[model samples]
Target: MQESKWWKNAVVYQIYPRSFKDSNGDGIGDLQGIIRKLDYLKELGVDAIWLSPVCRSPQDDNGYDISDYRDIDSMFGSLKDMEELIKEAEERNIRIIMDLVLNHSSDEHLWFIEARKSRENPYHDYYVWRDGTEGLPPNDMRACFGGSAWEWVPELSQYYFHQFSVKQPDLNWENPKLRQEIYDMILWWMEKGVGGFRLDVIDQIAKEPDLKITNNGPRLHEYIRELSKETFRKGDLITVGEAWGANTELAKLYSNPDGSEFSMVFQFEHINLDQQPDKEKWDLAPLDFLKLKQVFAKWQRELYRTGWNSLFWNNHDLPRIVSRWGNDKEYREKSAKMLATLLHGMQGTPYIYQGEELGMTNAEFEIEDYRDIETLNVYHERLEKGYQKEDILNSIHAKGRDNARTPMQWDDSPNAGFSEGTPWIRVNGNYREINAKQEMADKGSVFHYYKKLIGLRKTYEVFADGKFELLLEEDKDIFAYTRTSEGEKLLIICNFHEKEVPFLLPEGWSGKEEILIANYNEIAETEKLRPYEARIYRKA
Candidate 1:
């Protein structure tokens, strides 16, 4: 029999601490800021919070590069503050999940600092290193952030491998000593009472730079299984890996029923539909509604009873869903609710980004307004290739990471109530109308709609263990599906476009249905769905 998992039915909220709230007026959100807002999250009704990295770092990649695994960064808070945050959250019945960047560490880390001093240092084997060929890098492989993947050391006369920024050196997982160190660090955090971990860039850990392989390496699962046996299996923990290269076949190995690896993974196949194949994310392509529906249906069916899924639309590294897939201007509230219904009605754990529940829209940023490292690198790289500045700006507006990093809009006050002083990043211009304070007061707002959607997941048994079947597989405008369990059925229909679309009830699914939740207040009994309309019906 399959074992039950707490995270299976729980709704997780992802908080990017730097942008969530500022408590000390230092323009950056800190641990105390999150503590002050614990009541707010408790009222939102999330079961867990997945926080991005808050460990000690040089902020080269905005905290992904960890300099110390045992200590919290001074910028965020001390160890006591983190302990207090965890204790306070537990009192509110909410679990805390930390982000673990195991693939690399900051160059300033003591191990890396020692390893770079000399090739014969005791910590030299902690990182990947190679001898230069003809005074050049061992290979022509480029880094993910637009540079050589190997950085030369003048004193050592060798190159250290880095899949991301030069300041972030890739760790050598083949070393059992290094792996044990990582395991011990994870256990230390577990001892601190963390509920789980979100492994960052986990798929690239077993990479072979010499063979030009970056993801899904030969020993990938072997490493993951070993890591699981060493740490997570010791506790009832939830582990979700960020695997951009995963498909249904690989997903089974990562999140199989045997509990060998992770509980689930964050896949990007659906998120990549709008980008050109085998190209950078900035290479744009029109999103096909049919293709999007087909991808979701495939995962929902393939993972049923065999593994699990993680349903989400927005995160710290992507654009807002309302801006990317829905009409962010006129129908922001309606479209946001529609997208929420589509995701929450699925068979998986749903994650809500910090500002997403309030129907946050993308920022209208100019070149000077951008602060993300990836965005600035892409902008300069495209400009050097003769691409028009206007075109690059448009792409950034559509797909930049900064779109999701803007301060959370708590109210209409200056800086969106995120900070008393100047914000590190500019707030979205529509905060006056879309802030959370305004939504919580209005019953029909997106914030309340999200609350209802979350409540439905907790109340319905079919949502956690039901058979999923796509309703309108060939329909271009209406994305519909059904979930059935123990003779109870849920019909969920969503209009993908900004125009009214005809929705026909499947045979034997009409007249006996009760409206569970909807974005529009008055859903007509007629066959037409208004612009960005979404509705869920329950029948026994």
Candidate 2:
């Protein structure tokens, strides 16, 4: 809540533990595996690590289905391993942030298990339940993963709400006792030295009795305020909420200057700019450069003083950035570096997903190769409707979540040096060319460029706390911006296209400008930007 919090200066790195590295030779990443990679993260210069959910689960939706919030899953080692990871990460000055899935819990969770046994059970009200029969759901709302949002339970002659899968039941925030239980669990983790939490789909936590409507219910802010006051507020903690479908206005309300709720909220406007409206993730469209620029500009300018922005390009649940937005085949390194420059140059806390620094691309696997439950469900559903196999596979290749879920490319060894045993999912075939070991060895690599970008953020106050102003707003191929603070100013120019583009200098800025950082060695005297070229100029 303070003006000078540690998280404000952090460059967060998100680690999908299952794919980060396998230490026990079990072909899956664990807490101990993360412990082994602490030094690597420290060397990369990230200030915080956001580990996805690792609590006890049925592995139905990876670790998002939490059966026991207090204990660690055997697949991810134990509570002791997590404690050790916290201790080790603290030693390296890297704060550890847990992914807190507050919206739902695994069906196997004790509270959900007891609640479904009988209507009169003490825990019966912990989850949302309604009386209904099979195929006659209580509402017409579709689950995010697909199908109806309600699942029938024969034992209690009711249907429980599950916005994701039937195995994960949505918790009832209306119950005071249920809310208390969540707050207590948060306090438990806070006491364990966990720096903070990345709240999973937190806006969806507070919902109306009717399951048809989307987020932003009547009590959403109220519930978040109560949760903040009761749990994380007692300790100095950072909270970033995954606010699905949130816009700049709503985001400002969730994270105002008063810190009533979260430290910041991850808005989806930029990420969803390429998606076809009202269509599934597989349905795609070309990203509107103008719209993308507008969205970023709006967030930066609107949230300048009151709220903060969480800048990112790739995450565990999305396709790789290089493959999605850059020329992954030809200009992979250049474009990846350029994107990094553009993102880190902005006035926000940047989050680098694992392998992003190495210019890792999407895993263009076949239909049968996917392990994501959502992908499989959609694939089968399309198959039954006589949709061509090749068409479905093409969509999967373009937009499937599994594209970003591939195992980390540590080195060009067996299984990309990710594990000694067979990996749970196939590694990207390009690992041989783009691995951390190779990038670390090459001075002119994406990894080093990221290191430079992060160093710039740490050393310059303009990039972190300066006011943002969008430049070249009408330029189709060149994305430019300026950051101003006191007497210093930073000018960032990025070529989003693959061809050469002319960038005219702004008026009164023709004076001497020092090049702070760039993706290429030589700057064009003619003011022409090469393909995917990014440059940061400073004037003091």
Candidate 3:
């Protein structure tokens, strides 16, 4: 049997600081705002909090482009505030997980500034640079934000590569000095008592741009292993890598039993089901429920004991789960709870995005209301491609990252109680009906349902170490599975649509079962589940 780890069963709550809460009416959420909410997170029962970037930045890529790794941005707060937050959260038994963006740095970073000065500068090799052929870039490779990936720097008479925005230059992992600096920075944070880290775009760090290779590079595992030995291996920390290109085979190398790379990787195979396989994310396609089942089941079964998995449906870069997969209109609460049950029942560490517990739906934003860089870039790119404004808007409404960046709904007050002043981003208009204050006051709210799910994971070992087996694989409207561990068997059934569905017990399963948890108040023994209903049963 594999040895136990704290993060194996722990629940992580991801907080996008800018939208969580504002302190001192700054119109932006800060470390102090998170410190103020530690008690609330404790009540919600999350074991750790994954805070997005708070480092010094120019707001390019929303802090992913770090200007300085050693200081907090003034827009959020001071370094003292971060220290206090770490201490306060520790007192509440909640560990802080920092978002580490090691793949790139802001163009304003000291090293980048120095690198652009001249070719003979010691810092010139700190970033990926190549001599342009004739007058154009080395190749026509496109940036993630829609232009040529290579940007011209006249001072050096060369081009620097950036996988993302031009302002965020990719760091050269081939530089040993840069790697040492990163290791030292990580150790500095760990010494300050952070519980873990979430590596941003980690898989792309060893990218071979010259060969047109972006992720899962040839030296990827070698670099990751070196990183583990130099930093993560030194402490009992939980590390999750954002590997959009990782598959089942590659995931094993990342989260193998030896723990040489990371604790687990955040794979997008399941999330990309609704996207056209050969096209960009903006290209819409109906989600294939069967394919979704296959993706989840394959990962769950393959990584059962060989590696680990990170379970999550909502995050800062994606649309709300309730709005994307479930019926967010009339069956909002029911579908939210149903989706939570389906994911939490799997064997992995669950992540709950801020306000996700409140059943927060996607924002109804106009073109002018969008603030995310990716969203705006795609909107304009689609328009330039001659796509209709309505079609582009509809796709943005369905898949825009801004949908997840709206201010958190705290209460039915001015600005959703997120800020006393105008918010940096527009608040979701439905905050009056779906806010934390209102949900916490009602026992039947989605907030309480999520609280129960978090508690169940801690109380039941089956949820952590159980073997997962998908049931009713061909059923279009029902996602059903069974988890078994140490003579304990749990049958989880979820009705995914807005219609009644009959769930017949699989062969060898007896009718004498105890209801562990259910979304509906009354569940009839007739095996007929109502719209968006979820039930977990244990054989009695």
Where in model 2 is the C-alpha error above 4 Å? Answer: 1-4, 132-136
TM-score of 3: 0.97
- lDDT for 279 in candidate 3 is 91
lDDT of 1 by residue, 319-416 (tens): 99999999998998999999999999999999999989998988879989999978898899889999999999999999999999999999999998
| Whole-model lDDT, model 3 | 0.91
For model 2, name the residue pairs that clash: none
Candidate 1 local lDDT, residue 355? 88
Model 2 lDDT tens row, 1-540: 343466777899999999999998989888888898899899899989999999999988888889999999999899999999999999999889999898999999999989988999989999998988778988788887767888988878898888898888999999999999999999999899998899998888777657465578778999999998888678777789999768888888877767778889998888887878988767778989999999999999999987889999999989989988898988999999999988899877899999999999988888778998778887899999999998888778878888888999999999999999999999999899999999889999999999888888888888878999998898999999999999899988899989998777777577369898989997777878899999999998
Model 3 stretches with alpha carbons more than 4 Å out: 1-4
Among all windows of ten consecutive residues in candidate 1, which has the lowest summed lDDT?
A: 1-10
Sort by lDDT, best first: what order?
Answer: 1, 3, 2
TM-score, predicted candidate 2 vs. hidden true structure: 0.97
RMSD of each: 1.6, 1.7, 1.8
How many angstroms is residue 134 displaced in model 1 relative to the true structure, after the best TM-score fit? Answer: 6.2
- Candidate 1: clashing pairs of residues: none
Q: Model 3: per-residue lDDT, tens digit, 358-378? A: 999999799898888778888
Candidate 1 off by > 4 Å:
1-4
